[model samples]
Target: MEAITPFLNANQQISVDIKTLREAPDFKAGEVDIDIRNVTPLFLNQEEINAHYLTTYKFRLYASQAYVEEKGIPQSIHDLDAHTLISFTKDGLFPHTYEPQAIKCKQHLIIDCPLAIANAVENNVGIGPLLPHIARLSQQSLVPILHNQLRQSLNIYYTYPASLTQNRMVQDFYNYLQSLPEDFLKGRTHLLAKRPQKINPLSDF
Candidate 1:
């Protein structure tokens, strides 16, 4: 909702498909119009597609206060091995390098989407990596843990078919996205941050 609400309200007769693409979509076949992915494809053929540097997404470990109280805060990264950890399937740190195996997460869950990961954390399912902005989606506040230790910075790319570079709609939306600040995408500019937070109940039922 955060990324497309404005565009949806401003435009009409447009369809958008948002997902994590493991392989390049057949843009020419109209399989997809635009793709915003955190990891740049290792074999992005510059000759066929255009990849523009988007923004860097910083992910930190987050766990609901309830989860912390139940499982206890992981004092060290290794401590995560003893607790439930949620993460994307591959858990790639960067575009150039992907995780060779499911080693990052030592426990039950391999969510394929970041939004789902946030939901899992909000429900006190497990500690997982999430962008700061997505943290606000939770009804209850989620605390950042090992902020200094468990942090991931991945660069996102704005990709489209080289042939459609001149298309008005594509250019218009891309320009609008670039006009927004990096903080806006990362949750630094959210209303929840500015508003006074409601007090959490003192007792956990």
Candidate 2:
């Protein structure tokens, strides 16, 4: 929200609400002019709501250096059984293709917020999946586990009522959002340039 504040004119005012993407309130009643969400709500009326695909984000399993040194690195899906797992309290908007495999590991903790989960993993609580951008932002030196194997992707969207599409303030905000640098939206790979050396998958240890 802070990123686009400069674009608003003197007559324009803005209100921001942060909540789960699925719980985004209806904008048809004119309560909101724009609703930015990570996932498109299922109940959104296609005729009434206009959603613009913003960008795609990828997630990978991460483990703290402390945890890796203590439990040894997991090289295969079955190896996860020997390590503790951290997960969200609710299944998130991302796809669950890798969930079944994750369930096989012993769950060490469940967190409601993604940031909190990353913090716990960083504190050496357990290994868990998180967005690479977020992990890097935390500045905790987390090792990417199964980097070539397990992964999930999500697309962010900017949605607004069809009626508000022509509103000057709304359009200006939309334009600013669209103009964001690609690296800012998708994150930079150089953030992970110093990532620890990859673990050998076939090592017996």
Candidate 3:
């Protein structure tokens, strides 16, 4: 936040309104020039914006290196069906979708929060997903489970208010956010400009 302050406050004519990525879809829902575009990942389809590509996370299964080395790595998503999955009840963090055949784990452990999920995974209660930051913090207590395929990162965006076009401060702030260090929007992985190798979110863009 401090790094971008200089840019946002450079002009005092207008104040920029910062909003979440989910709020961007409705930027121009009923207005004009309030277009919402996907600015990250430099996808092919500029029309459909995905906040996911702008973020990154580590994909891990709760298991010791010794155990995995002996059992072999999970080769497919379906392989997870045989393993217990610990997840947080918090909203918007875990991936959610309507799947008629979604498997119900043999033991669905309910944790109080995200930290609890990581704790459970560290104890080898079950394999689970976690952000890279949290994973790094908990590494000494847990094991990293590798997968045959890498997981897709999360996406985030900043929406510009339609009515603030004439405001220099607001527009400058928007441009500054657009120019934010890619790692700031996304998670730390490769260099900010280095695009992901496998999970190319821009295939639709």
Candidate 4:
């Protein structure tokens, strides 16, 4: 959203209302200009909505240092059952397909917010899946668990009215999104891994 702020400021005519897509609001009302979602909308065939492919994000299971010390790292999927698990309350957005049912059944704590889940894991509440970008940003050092085996990915999409495809502001925002560099999202993950400093746990909130 910050990437296109300058354009929005200059245009003055274009405004954006960001909302979670899970609530199933009326996008056809003509008031909502763009709807960005982490998952694909179920009503894509509604004829009024046009979805645009944004980008794909990679995710991995992460555990706090304290949790790892206590439970030890999970060597395999079967071993995960022995450890406490942290997960999102919404099953649809769990992000892992390898062992979706198994993981869901083993959740020790169900959290609605992603940041809260990360914080809980940092505080040694449990192990959970997180995007590399989010893991790097957290104040706690999250060790990647089952990194080689439990990798997962999700695609992000933005939807708008087909009729608004020709709108200059909409086109400009879309173009700005496409202009982002390939490594732009992963740069922090790589940099953080090499740093020796520890992050303050309080800053995570």
* Candidate achieving the largest lDDT: 1
lDDT (Cα, tens digit) per residue for candidate 3, span 15-131:
333322321233334221122333444432444322322223344445545445544555665565566666543322243211232445555565534566777767666766666
lDDT digits (tens) for residues 1-205 of candidate 4: 3444564577554333433434434545533456554533455666777777767778678999888998898888788878887765545325433234544435577776666777888899888877788888788888998888767676655666677667655666667667887434331110001112211000000
Compared with the true structure, what per-residue lDDT tens digits does model 1 show for residues 73-124? 8777677777887766555421223544334545667776567778888999
| Model 1 regions more than 4 Å off | 8-22, 90-97, 100-106, 181-205
The clash numbers for all candidates, in the given order, read 0, 0, 8, 0
Which order, best to worst by lDDT? 1, 4, 2, 3
Badly placed stretches (over 4 Å) of model 2 are 8-22, 29-31, 40-45, 90-102, 183-205
lDDT of 2 by residue, 1-205 (tens): 3444454343233433323333454564443445554544463447777777766768788999888999889998678888877765434322333244434655556664667778888899888878887778767788988878777776666666676556555565556658886545542110001112211000000
Q: Measured by TM-score, how close is model 3 to the native structure? A: 0.46
- The top-ranked prediction according to TM-score is 4
Worst 10-residue lDDT window, candidate 2 = 196-205
For candidate 2, report its TM-score.
0.73
What is the Cα root-mean-square deviation between model 1 and the actual structure? 11.3
TM-score of each: 0.73, 0.73, 0.46, 0.75
Clashes in predicted model 1:
0
Question: Lowest lDDT 10-mer window, candidate 4?
Answer: 196-205
> Which residues of candidate 3, in runs, are more than 4 Å off?
1-82, 88-93, 96-101, 110-116, 137-142, 174-183, 186-205
